[model samples]
Target chain A: MENDKQKFRLLDTLYILMMIVPIVFGIVLKILTTPQSEGIAISGAKIFFTINLPIQNLPITESQIHSWLVMIAITGLCLFLTHGLKEKADTKRQHIAEWIVENAQKLVIDNMGDYFSGFAPFIAAILSLSAFSSLLALFGLYAPTSDVNVTAGWAILVFFLITYYKMKCGPVVYAKSFGEPVPFLAPLNIISEFATPVSMAFRHYGNVLSGSVISVLLAVGLQGLSSMVLGKLPGFLGEFPLFQIGIPAVLSIYFDVFSGVLQAYIFAMLTMLYVAGAFPADEYFRRKAKKSTI
Target chain B: MLELAIGIILGSCALGAGVAMIAGIGPGIGEGNAVAKACEAIGRQPECKGSVTTTMLMGCAVAETTGLYALVIAILLIFVAPGRLVDILMETIK
Candidate 1:
């Protein structure tokens, strides 16, 4: 009992120290480093490759690097977790793996119906990738979703799937569907069809980019406020950014954690719904009938 | 003349962004109404909460597309448009 109490106390101290050390380090770093006047630059990928022959520069951006990191981390985790799987699950890792797979299956089944069960892997991958990329911003990495290109890539894939499924119904039916209810609205129908991917990509990119912009502004603003408050103090003490720590963390919770998860979920949910909507109308009714009968 | 042009450009962009944000009011009211109805439904039948929430979120997402359109416009006006306008003014002055 005493040993357990000692262990708890040690952990509590370690946690407190862990929290405080970062703030102290950040404050010291702030004092040491000159702050830039301009906020974070909104720019494209930095070029990493140079060709000697034609003098071509191949650029790799922060988004690509961070996304690659996320992919590697996720792949490593999955491999590590599922390394030793037995018929009878014993370890915590196996249990977690099973739970994740089961929930993903359930999500796909619930949203897209049993007829689209094959889409489970794709949906799971998108959900995990989106969530991880968004959460990457919390660690001060450039979130891949902040780039419109990344989101557009995902949206284009979804667009292709939606179009392909609609085309599968019949080329005549597909072409004629655009003119249905009123022939005059055909142009509008076609525009709206194209608008799907654009809107999806823009929605996600805008949310994440706005969140990043706001947080950067907040941090800079906080630093300014801190310097003003601390500037009154004598000598070296005036240089410290006292207000930089703890305060912005409260806002970060909402901007980073909450919004990131929500946007990721919304993006995945929209993708699933758009794809499911492309399935034949009769299949939906049939599924509904089956569920009702069961 | 240059100062006036720059001022006008910045002012117009700000005004446009503000106007774009006005689209938020629609989604605000819509999502509120949706959640309120979902809550009422859940109150009437607690067992249907899962389906009710999912449907509510889906409806809310559809409703939010208009707001997102406004946001995209606002972002363009605030970030991209200003820079291009400034560049154009510089070229004109040159």
Candidate 2:
């Protein structure tokens, strides 16, 4: 028992040392490299390609590259997880695969009702993509959701699905929905329909981008604060970024992890709700009415 | 004159951002209400906590959309519009 206690204490000390060493190194590097006067500049994604065509130059941005990386990573992980299958319930991989599939199915069925449960895979894919893309910012990658275009793309797809499902009820009914309760309200209804995609896209994009901007500002501000406090010290000690180590990590938990996960879930949930709402409610209501009359 | 125009632009941008952030009050109140109700529901029936929480979060996110729209506009006003306005002002003066 005594031996175990000593071993645990040594391990705990080693773990703390491991964490502290890198942070101290990072602080030294940051102080040595960064100029005091320059505030951190928040800018859009860097363009990697400018294909010179006769008409226009098509530029591929950092967000596009990062999204591709995220896609490849998810695909590779899925492939690795599902490489082998067996009748016997044995492997951990199989357990995880089953759990994921089961939860996805349940999420769609529960949120979208029984009729629209066919959309489970699609919803799962969007949720995974959005979550992964948003979380990528934690690793210093340009998050795809930070770019409006990426979120717009997803929103547009959801918009198309909603319209398609709505039209499936009947073209006349779909068109008449714009008028809603009164004919004069048609323009307002139409505008609200258009606003759906715009709002969805902007919400995700703004949340992720704002979180990133705040994180950057906080880091720069902390560095400035450290310099103000530490500059009184003699020589090399004055240059140390004393405040930069543990403080930003706490903020990062909220900005990167919480916001990233929440925004992704919100986007997916909104898409599911909107798409499910577009489905015809006539049959369900008619059945309920018949039951009541009986 | 240029300096005065610049000051006006900066001042208006700051005011616009503040005004835009005021939209946050609605969502704050709405989400707070939602959470309060959800908490009450959970307190009454602990078994339904998961579903209640999910529903509450969904409603809160929807409520947040209006604030987010305002935030986008505020960000544009503060960051993008001011720079362009100053450029246009300089051109006009020239």
Best by TM-score: 2
lDDT of 1 by residue, A1-294 (tens): 999888756765654554345434433543444346655455543443444555665456656666676776666566666765799999897999999999989998988989888888888888888988888767665678888888999999999999988876568768887887899999999999999999899888877877877777887788788878888899889988688778878877887787777778888899888888876778546767898999
Candidate 2 lDDT by residue in tens digits, A1-294 = 999888756765554554345334433543554447665778777675688889988787877777776776677567655645578758897899889999999999988998887898898899999998887777666788999999999999999999998887568878978877999999999899999999999989998988888888998899899999999999999989899999988888898888888989998899989998987778546756898999
DockQ of 2: 0.66
TM-score, every prediction: 0.81, 0.85
Candidate 2 Cα errors over 4 Å, as ranges: A1-39, A53-56, A281-294
**Prediction 1 global C-alpha lDDT:** 0.80
- Highest-scoring model, DockQ: 2
TM-score, cand. 2: 0.85
CAPRI tier for the interface of model 1: medium
Candidate 1 Cα outliers beyond 4 Å, as residue runs: A1-58, A281-294
TM-score, candidate number 1: 0.81
